[model samples]
Target: MSDNSQSAAALVQRYYDAFNAGDVPGMLACLSEDVAHDVNQGGRRTGKALFGEFCAHMERCYREQLTDIVVMPSADGRRAAAEFTVNGTYLSDDDGLPPATGQTYCLPAGTFFDIADGKITRVTTHYNLQDWIAQVTGTGA
Candidate 1:
């Protein structure tokens, strides 16, 4: 891989490391000031402040640690993607979702990223919401 690609991978790795550590500030430090976040199965939210809010909301509702992370960066270093397994417990009720009762789940997820000046400018996360719902509701096959 090129040096740029290596750096991009490192940046993504750092972001996940912070996430696994439950270090919100550390994760935010890897983002651009005007970063855009495309919520999984939801609309896009722009700016680091909004991202911080999202993180806070997640913190309140769930406890997650991402494992088996694989980061792939484009040769140009302007984009990247990561795949991981989210091992989590639903801690509190989130809006429009099933009531939380400390249900545990393991879900495979991925995130696409756009990087500039060594900071993430955009983040788009993806996962099967229905599958997650089924798992949490004890309806999964």
Candidate 2:
């Protein structure tokens, strides 16, 4: 692995560390000003301001804990993939649309990050929505 690859992996690690520490500001620091984040289970959040909103919403809805984080080089050194499990506790009533049962849930997710100029420029995240619904509602197929 080259130095760039190692650095990229390190950056991904930092992201997970920030998340586990609940340091939203620190996580944002690892991103570029024009960062594009697609929180698959959530929605697309672009730019720093919108990203901050998304983070705030997440903090309001769930207490997040990153259980396992594994970072690896992707197609090139500039890109990396991180697989992680995020366990969350429902904090308040779900008021967005269909009300939630207000139950705790564990979500296993993966993220692919593209780094540029030592910052994360883009991130594509994946997770099972049905599993999340099941964990929250205690009902599913």
Top TM-score prediction, candidate number: 1
**What local lDDT does model 2 show for residue 113?**
89
lDDT of each: 0.96, 0.83
Query: Per-residue CA lDDT of candidate 1, range 1-141, in tens?
Result: 999999999999999999999999999999999999999999999999999999999999999999999999999999999999999999999999999999999999999999999999999999999989998999983
Candidate 1 has a TM-score of: 0.98
Which residue pairs of candidate 2 clash? none
Error of 2 at 133 (Å): 0.4
**TM-score for predicted model 2 compared with the true structure:** 0.89
TM-score of each: 0.98, 0.89
Residue-pair clashes per candidate = 0, 0
Number of colliding residue pairs in model 1: 0
